[model samples]
Target: MVVMGSGGHTTEMLRITKHLNKERYTPRVYIVSSTDTTTISRVLAGEDSSGTYTICKIPRSREVKQSYLTSIFTTALSTVSSFPVVLWHRPQLVLCNGPGVCIPICAVVFLAKALFLIDARIVFVESLCRVKSFSLTGKILMFFADKILVQWPDLCKVSKRADYIGRL
Candidate 1:
């Protein structure tokens, strides 16, 4: 199962799923966020849908910016909601694209003893001369992920847990 922050990432993830060998692997997508209207409309809903995909909206207002009060409230609520979703799906493996949306859900998967794969790559290294705040999520991911994959070797350098998986 694949879980992520938003529809754009979901679209990219679906592209990755397209490469999987269907005979060996069946793909199911789960979107974890406050809402995924675009993903639900474009991918999760349709006559072609087989109900293989599901969406779980964490109970939080749609505010991208972080605040101490909102973070505590949302995190608590989302953490509470994550269990039933994990129990319902019981996926053998869970893949995550780095974001706050996946945090509580990944915790659920870990608590359920499911394997986790985290997509973590360092970006803007040359342009910005450093990894950004986005890359900090990689550190959090490394703590839980069974396998932490990085597109660049530079990212591997920062995270002791990462394996060089080639450029994404």
Candidate 2:
């Protein structure tokens, strides 16, 4: 499973997918924000749509510049709604970067893991832009993500949970 945010996040995901051996990762599931209009085209254009992937959308937990306090309610609601989606996909692994939508999906995956509904792993890669510090989503996921990969050595120092993977 691949979860993407808009713009740069989507671009990075598409770039990462180019290296995937589709034979090993069949029927890929991509999670994107419902409000994002551009990512779909980018996926269709850049990815091989040879019937090997599925795209799913969930509500965006918080918009850019959305108040942190109000985001609490929105994130909770999105997490609830994401349960069914996550259950349906039942991804063995969820790969995501910093994005509000990824939070709800990853949360559902964690909850499913706790409840023994399914065994899913989360691989979170901090964006290259986050050289000095983690984004809000990255900070929140640092504890829950099975693997926290950082593109820089500095970030690894900031969070022991993060491994310096060097620009991935």
Candidate 3:
């Protein structure tokens, strides 16, 4: 199973999984922001639940806040609160689009001994958190990520396991 953030990234993540041999991949959705509109729950309740479940009610920030401290605090708090949910899901791999929803879920994956796989397109700094926090965050993900797929080759500079795949 895999966890991803919202919007185009989520769409791409879903598309990639669909091509995986169903005998191997079982896709599920986990919504990570409070305000970001997503259909993970509906998808889970309706068609997607064949081997899937919904993880709802996550706190997502709307815009980059004026106060960095406040933004960090809220994001961190939301992430910390979400640890248990990730444990319950017990996914084998997590594919993050970027920081929007993946941050918190990655933290939980860290604590749960699950693998973390990040998409390659988000090689820019904006895709991640602060540099000070990067080391620890990267440590958690890097130590466990089975693979890091990149849609862009430039991402290889920052990625731990860079694989060149077409953009999702």
Candidate 4:
């Protein structure tokens, strides 16, 4: 499963997946926020609707300029809504970059792992735009992800576990 954020995050996610070996990563599941219609369209455009890939929508963690209280409530709702999907799919790998939507999904994956409900590996790739430091989502996911990849060599200093794998 892959989390598709908005704009740059979505673009970077798509770019990285484009190089994946189809035989190894077939029948991909893409998770997008409910308000992210543009991302849904972009993902669909690249997918082979012949049952090779699917796009799943969940509520957004928050809207632009949304109140903190509202964001918290919605995030919790999104997390709850995502539980069944994560449990049902039980993907071997959950890939994501920096996105608000990733917070809830990653939390679910972490809890699922702790409970032995699923054996999914969380791989987080920081965006190429983040040259100096980790984004909010990246920082939050650091503890949960099995591997955290950075495009910049400077970011290697940010975390001992971070890998400077060049741009994706």
Highest-TM-score candidate: 2
lDDT of each: 0.55, 0.88, 0.52, 0.89
TM-score of each: 0.73, 0.96, 0.64, 0.95
Candidate 2: give the clashing pairs: none
Candidate 2 matches the true fold with a TM-score of: 0.96
Stretches off by above 4 angstroms in model 3 are 27-29, 39-51, 61-66, 114-144, 157-160
Mark the 10 consecutive residues where model 4 has the least summed lDDT. Answer: 44-53
Candidate 4 deviant stretches above 4 angstroms: none
Model 1 CA deviation exceeding 4 Å by range: 45-51, 60-62, 114-134
| Tens-digit per-residue lDDT, 1-168, candidate 2 | 999899999887887787888888877888888889999888888667488888888888998899999999988888988998889989998999888899999888998999999898999989989999999889999767999988889998898899998876
Ranking by TM-score: 2, 4, 1, 3
lDDT per residue as tens, model 3, 1-114: 344556655566556555656545444545546665564643343344365445556676324443655667776877876676665655655655444556566666665553
In model 3, pairs of residues that clash are 33-58, 33-60, 34-58, 34-59, 34-60, 120-150
lDDT of 1 at 155: 62
lDDT of residue 124 for candidate 3: 17
Give the C-alpha miss distance for residue 71 in model 4, angstroms: 1.9
Worst 10 residues of 1 by lDDT: 121-130
Angstrom error at residue 7, model 4: 0.8
Can you write out model 4's per-residue Cα lDDT over 81-111, one digit (the tens) per residue? 8898899888889999888898889899899
